[model samples]
Target: MKKLFYFLFVLGIVSCSTSSDDTLENQQNPTDLEPNKAFVYYMESPKVSSLQPSWYYTFNYKNGRLVKMIGKFVKSENIWSPDNFYSDSFTTLSYHNNKIELKFSNDTYPTIVYTMENDKPKKAELYNQFNELVTVKTYTYESGKIKIYSKTYTLETYYTYYLDSNNNLIKSEKLEKSGGLDKALTTTTYSNFDNSKNPFKKLYLLNDNFYEKSLSNNNYRKINYTIQNLQNPEYLPEIGNAEWTYQYDLNGQIVLHHPL
Candidate 1:
């Protein structure tokens, strides 16, 4: 079923990463998200119009590389203050010769090691706190955008990204492997983008939750399409078609966002 409406909030995805030769990574690696000093110091997840409990995170960069992320606080009803960080909210990044290692404050998570090409991931390896390998992730890129991501832990999840000529995301698909067949679970599409800069562009590996409109030329209209029954191989229900818009500041920055 396809569902659409005047979006109350847009979900921006900070996707995760893969492996390869790395002798020249330091020299060949593209610059990080912060360029031209257009730093997105602070970001609020679930940038919904209504007031509610939301996660707030602050970003830090060194030499243009995203080095750390700290979840400062959460909104509780009407009061906005810091009681404590939400669970597993602190993350640290390490840039190395071959890959970038991401460690979370929560001990339960494995360190995610990602290799890169042109600022996108090529391979990833996860290790437990005990330094034992937990799993390995891989990716496929076309035209500098990650086309396919394969993650295998207890179960396997595959994601495919489709981009337009402007290198903006057009759609994304979630696929699952079952019975030696790839089963598509969901598909999301983005459109009607304003010709402005996407502050979140090139900000890879910031968060695990990635959406189809996560990175684009500008904030765009998002329409999600779900298969009523992919196995049935027939028609799906119609989605509510609604138009959406966003307000941007004069500086071309999205006004919905705020500084840290």
Candidate 2:
């Protein structure tokens, strides 16, 4: 199933929408582009102790939305081991207006919710740990892009995106339906673009009911590369081909993306 829709579209859990504005712009500037911390390095070998950093991340925001997130692993070079940290695997968030909910202090993890209406998104739900309801994604939009549909009672997936009049996204596709037919496995495309860095523009600039306003600046451009074409293709020829690099800070955000 195209790696299960690329692991539920890289974990955003699936949902999309746009439209909103009320002179938007709510207090940002917690050091201008709040990212707080991150680190992840690799490349081992026995040459001069070769780089390290196995994992790290820390972020928290309130007015600008992120809410909370924490992770840690690196326990060697540049150390980081508050006793092997993992405080229940942190992650928390909750918002209302346009809906949002991501809870996971490890209750066997599973809780994600999102909903929006005329202003896009539309639905995404997945609850567990006694709250039941395991999956249901929906979302639709045409000419302006977006098309997800993930149900679950065995399986049913589909995703599609293709945007570029500055809406960024570029391309993506994946399907899977089986007995009722809807094959096609994967296709992805994206190009170079840095037009002023965009690392997910802080997921639509932190709650104004999860604002959108045509994606404000059209979903933060900066995608330098991505190309995945697979329909079996030997099961995954090393991601088919990949390359991406990024690093920014003087307010351009990002901070580093690597992937080469």
Against the true structure, whose lDDT is highest?
1
- CA-lDDT, candidates in order: 0.56, 0.52
- In TM-score terms, candidate 2 sits at 0.26
lDDT of 1 at 120: 60
Candidate 1 residue lDDT tens string, 112-153: 888866656778888788988776778886673555555555
Please give the lDDT score for candidate 1.
0.56
Model 2, range 1-260, lDDT digits (tens) per residue? Answer: 99998988876633432222111123232333455554432111111122234444566876665677665332345334222445346667666656767776665435877776664458878788888888888888887577878877767888777776667666666666655555446565555555554433453422211222123233232223232333454544323423334466575545632333
Candidate 1 runs further than 4 Å off: 1-54, 72-88, 143-145, 178-184, 208-214, 227-247
Report the C-alpha displacement of residue 110, candidate 2, in angstroms: 14
Worst 10 residues of 2 by lDDT: 42-51
Clashing pairs in 1: 2-239, 13-210, 13-214, 18-122, 18-123, 18-124, 19-123
